[model samples]
Target: MNHLLIATLLVCLSTTIRAATATPPPVPDVEIVLRETQPLTFPRGSRLPLYLWTPNFPTADDAELERVLKALEARGIALFARWGGNDFAKASAFPLRVARLQKKLGLETSVDATGLAHGFYNGTPATGHVDKDGKRFFDKSFFWSPGCPFAVQPRYDAMRARLEPWLEKYQDEQLRLDFWAADWEFDGPNEWNSGWASARQCVTCRAQIPNLDTDFAAFQTAVRKVRAEMQREVFVKPIQRRFPNARIGNYAMNPHDGRRYWWDFFEKRTDGLPAKAEHGALYRPWAREFEDCGYTVAMPVIYTWFNLHGEYPFANHQYRWFYNLLLEASSTGRHTTPAVPRVTFVHWTTTNPPKELPKDFEALTETSYEELLWHLLLRGHDTFAMWCPAPELAQEVRPVHRVYAAALEYKEFLDHGQPVLFDVPKQPGFVVSALQLGKKLLIRRTDFGPAPAFFELKLANGTTLRVPKVDGKCLLLTTP
Candidate 1:
């Protein structure tokens, strides 16, 4: 009897082993790994600076739209056009028109998904709310609240789940949740009207996460577990199940903290990272989250906010000082994307200006547009997505679009080649700096003092040349 029992036990153990090693359920059929090994460096391939905007730009008639599209086609600029979703129109009226433009020009299109605001899938409508602190407020007339039942994370999951069919249905190369940025920061001007204070008090949030009588720390722990599940069930899982190969990313709206609590809550919900991380510590959670989840994250900074003059100009200075730091933080553990304010955006120049510039600034004597683009590029960003204002506004802005187009064309040249040299000198004293990438060179001129001084670019092949009459005091020399 003992021998028989031993033999039976061995057989059972073998069966268990075989079951454990039986291919692990086919690994979910998702290709999380890529053939390319190293982290994807920016400029993987060049993409022109993009302009993101609603088709409802003031005075944006059909003819104007066609003209602007033609201009973008000629300049090879990508247009991140927001399909009209507001009361002005129900569905995008320009899809066919834009499609023809893209096909004719070989351009790419990503829909401006405003579903979060439109309450398309399952996002919470922007119900006016009161904060825990007893402040009442509401997002602007068009914006919607992102607060939803934790159980509805599956709704978010389904939101993207619906994207796969849309992609195949539309034959799209990429999709951008353009305006559906899940921003929860309430620092602008609202008084917190809804009174739905604290995630702990959230009815759906509480149901999704039990243990309310637990300590704050313990509750936080529970929230973390649920948050992970939410992310998986909501964003990542459904995305993998549906598209499997779709390039997905969340668009961040708030620029850098400044009364913003979205990142803070997001960090806590994800991994308890502090919002005020000393010198970029706050970004690790999102970075780690995106990396682990296998997706891209886009954080858009208010680069246009750096030029506010007067007492506000000092604020702009503060913004400038923190710009690079913010980029570093946002890119931490994640890929970085830099987007500039489109020259076409009229308010961009008037709203954001160096204390020295006028309200309706026509030209900038201190900094050139190319210098701005180069600076954005140097900060380790992959794509350039900007907001495009109207054509009349573009014309009034001293033709900055012309400068933008030129820089974009040059960007294509620089992306594949190595930069051999670069230099930038601020105005006044002609502060000059030069840098070399591979076979290309960049030279910059700035206002330091008051001296008309210049630098010469000499190549290893004994070639010499002077700077051109460029909008921004910048120069680029590339090899074939």
Candidate 2:
């Protein structure tokens, strides 16, 4: 046989063999129950997708839950069942059922389990801290006293026991071990204050580090050591061994607060005393651990409060800084990989009642929400999660729907295009977010105050695309 003919025959044979072995993707029941609707469209790029963070109400009637799932499906959103606190075994069932229901409804869902970094006293009595007088210190925060020893072994065993059965049960689902490292500090000299003082009182902890309190440097060192131990013993090792295939991640606080706190600490300002210690150092090691164990890691960019209060106008800058810091640290040999840093733009207070809202809280305007979404996208973050406590609130609040619609639109635009080089113009008062996908380039211009008459985009091919005003705002432009 001729060489070319033989090669073609071999290719055909390989293709046939692959086809014979290939397994079909699961067909969801919802697809059959409800006819597929037309995909949403955006003027530029594609629709942005949203993940709904619903409270994990275990006792909610199945029918009501299904209705909620169906409503979310209609809106083109996925569900994120939020379950916090201890009692993992009991709480695990809620998310498991939610996941099952979502799968049954043909909607997407993640298995979210909370892993408290510092032990909770009420949930696990043994984890509480005793004062010098032998009285247990109890605080509203639920964090054990600083000098108390974290029941690392007990917590780890409990977590493993609780999660193993679920992992085996839902072998196909992704498990997010949302680390509620509540009140852990990431900056300054006071970084270890969360539990250090009380931790020192624990006999076991004191035996290990007798000088933890007396020596500030020793306390910091001990805190780092304990953090690493907790990351390994409490989370990474057990999860990797038991649920090897699960998509695991920890909950990270909004990076802006961390940055500002650290900035203030380093500047010796008393106002924003460091909340956590050495933000980068605290997260970098954990990021590496997640990457090494083949798990997903997320850092949330919480711009809602700032946007609401209007304290920070240029919040995106801080977000960009935080992301870049992590990116740089997580980068290896000029490429960033499975350290797949997911930046979740979180707006948790949307569910707060009007009376409960902060004094500085201003209802997030649709324009502001859209602008923030675009700003984060421009900074190279696509994954987003919004905490909407109740589904009905989306209807009650017009801007919530508007914000979600923009996200869906952005996701659609992204799906249709490949990201290319884009730069922020040096000129003041305006910023341009541009991406060239295929033959067309989608550009969105955002102005600080008044809308500019028009902005000119100088493309690589020496083409000038003039983006004029659309509905009194600088909307997206598609240029070849």
Candidate 3:
């Protein structure tokens, strides 16, 4: 055989053997190139602002509040804080009667998560309600407000009296907020925290659903409508009755597609997940509740809770985990024309931290954490709303400020630009997503592993990106 032919035959044989093996080893020095497509577009005159919801700073002293507000203003935070007293006052901004530090610092303030759940949705002992049989409505869980359907209507009238003070206070235009979210999650007529069947075994609920004994589906359907009714009457009507233009929504209101992720991977067991019997089946079916309530903004959540991150196979990395949540938000949250503004509540801190993990687990470092924010913006989310713990404030806010600076640096692209490359490449190690407006293409790429990476990124418009090696950090670049 000729030397060239003999050499080619040996190379082909080696390649064939490698391909024939099961679960072939990862290729070294892999090159990944992704094309841009399916950008979340914005209509003319509408722009997504760079916003952050900071925990309330000291408002007791004029000088101290101004100093803190000025410091955050310098860091490019345009939004922060909620309002009210008791627990809600902890998040209150501009609460000082003599001081309005936000005006001085040019930071915007908003209200968040009013304690509706705290006030009315606790167990019957706490909520002070009884079933038609003169027994406490409490069941296996404290979130048992689904009983006595007739009792809920009468409770709403009483709620109006208590809610009046807050609404009256915000009537001051200077104190008014354009956004509001309710603290009604995990406390309504839902099956997650506890089943409503026990509570609904009453005169009123059974009267409405005469055959609830034989059919649980009727109870489930009726309770969802009851929850929707609660949202409209309890949260929306009361708040919107005061501020007609306000964008109103609540936490966990966005349809979650009936799946909850909690500590389990492709090759792991489900022993660590929260028990179904204790927490009930984690399911929130789409009920068109937001649409019925006329929600202006979709309040979907993309959290970095370590335990909640492990249920799916693709969630091997924090970056991948957050991206999946974002995918969930954008897919279900924006399934309409003139997409509802997704002012998503995102957190990078380890909420519900798992007790143990795979030995090779990668907690979100500085680069990976910041990448979460950038991906949210590039994935069509309108704002980055967060609450940093006071102790971890300095470290966590590093990513927030850095991402905010990029928002200012590329304001045009962020303001008017639609995000391209929303679909990520399926391969591991290399991840790329982008945004484009007209001729401007702003792409964000982060490769896994320690070594610096350089790769070619091809675009559908016949443009190719050749950038310097990104040393295991997020790379945000624009191409004209």
Q: Tell me, by lDDT, which candidate is best.
A: 3
- Candidates 1 and 3: which is better by lDDT? 3
Runs with alpha carbons beyond 4 Å of true place in candidate 3: 1-54, 78-82, 85-107, 122-136, 142-150, 172-174, 196-203, 206-221, 255-284, 312-323, 336-339, 354-360, 420-430, 448-480
Arrange candidates by lDDT, highest first: which order? 3, 2, 1
Indicate the residue-level lDDT of 363 in model 1: 35
**Mind giving the per-residue lDDT tens digits that candidate 1 earns over 1-480?**
699999999999999999998876422101111111112123223453434332232224566656655544444344443433343223444553555455555555544444422332123433223345544333332233434323334344334444344334343434322222222222111112221234444544446445643443344444344433444454545545545643344444212323231222112222332234433223222212323333333444433333222222222332332333234323321232223211112123433334576563343222443344454444333344443344323322223334444444446443543333323221123333334466665554444334444445566778765644343455665634
Per-model lDDT: 0.38, 0.44, 0.54
Candidate 1: regions farther than 4 A off: 1-46, 52-71, 81-93, 116-149, 157-165, 172-197, 200-250, 253-299, 306-347, 350-370, 388-392, 395-400, 408-413, 417-436, 439-472, 475-480
Candidate 2 residue-pair clash tally: 32
- Worst 10-residue lDDT window, candidate 1: 28-37
User: For all candidates, what are the clash counts?
Assistant: 56, 32, 1
Best by TM-score: 3
Of 2 and 3, the candidate ahead on TM-score is 3
